[model samples]
Target: MKINVPFSIAIAVLSAIIALLGYFIENSLLNQIRSSLLQSAIILAGVALIIGVINMMRVHWVEMRGGKGNKIYHLTFFAGLILTLLLGGWFGMSNPNGYWLYEAVVVPVEASLMAIMAIFLTYLLTKIINRRKDFFSIVFLVTVLVGLLTSAPFLGQEIPFIATGNSIVKSLLHLVSNGAMRGILIGVALGSIATGLRVILGSDRPYGG
Candidate 1:
């Protein structure tokens, strides 16, 4: 008797069995096998990330050599990347210099970008209200304003009525926003499980084999 199987199918079957065994059988050897497999995956992921970064740098470097007008941006990117890596290597991540570099450089830049995004979102809301002028648009605008007011500092402290209103708005936001987030997470988890099942059953071949 002869048994023939595709290499991808064989690997998938083995992986699924090993994963199941790791989960269901609480044996020491099975736990060790699971840990080894996880470590191998992590190492492979790290290698892939490094390769991706090098490839991106090579592409940008090539573009700079081709006299791209965005050479300054590419140069700035490489400069930041190299500086951060060198500082991290030299000072260590927990060192004061590394912390200072992060607080002084990374935090401010991130905050500025977030501020810019908030401004853009406000502008977009204004445009939507002006153009739509519908019931839903009015409701959306009101909701956004209420949300912003609830988050604003000193508004609650200054006015008693405003403080009560902010409290109500915050309660509504927490209830609705948290419920929606939970629903989204549950949906994502279900989708992930279905995909994993498909992959394990050989119905899906993500590796193109």
Candidate 2:
């Protein structure tokens, strides 16, 4: 027997609407339903993550056994994953060791990745500027330049933008961070709504697979 996809989508959409309504409504029943829905969602998300991780591990294990090129990358990945899990388990909740690993290794690695992204963005902007000298391109160039300037000091600036508590620098930092986050989140929300609508209309049968 085929699964009832329409029935499933109806339940999903109803549950979502109830959950949203619970936030604005003052009814106890609505809140309880919303809480149950949220718990169900969390469990489903956790299961999905576990399934994804297992799939990844299986694929990587097969590649490892193939004994082909770049075995070192496979070895490094398993080593790091195992090490991270061991550290987290041993450290428990009050984590000095886990925090140390994150600060020592992860932070610098993430920062380096971000720096590379900025470099690529600048390169892309140069291409855009050459192709089209538009208002938006100019704005993009200016934004990139300001972001780069505020991020680091050149030659150990004697005129550091240091105020009493460097409030000016902090303000600009917060402003930029908040603006970028809001813009990204708004885009995500819009895309999510569009995808959900597609699912609802059965125009996209993601569940069929």
lDDT of each: 0.81, 0.76
* C-alpha-based local distance difference test score of model 2: 0.76
Runs off by more than 4 Å, candidate 1 = 1-9, 97-104, 127-140, 153-162
What are the C-alpha RMSDs, in order, of all predicted structures? 4.5, 5.4
> Candidate 2, clashing residue pairs?
none
Give the per-residue lDDT digits (tens) of candidate 1, residues 1-209.
12334776787777777876798889998889888887887899999999999999998899999987688989998998888888888999999885666888889999999999998988898899679878989987887776766666563464343335447667877798899899999999999989888888888877655
Candidate 2, 49-104: lDDT as tens digits: 99998898777788989976588888887888788878878886368886666777
Model 2 RMSD in Å is 5.4
Supply every candidate's count of residue pairs whose N, Cα or C atoms clash at under 3 angstroms.
Answer: 0, 0
Question: How close is every model to the real structure, measured as TM-score?
Answer: 0.73, 0.67
**TM-score between candidate 1 and the true structure:** 0.73
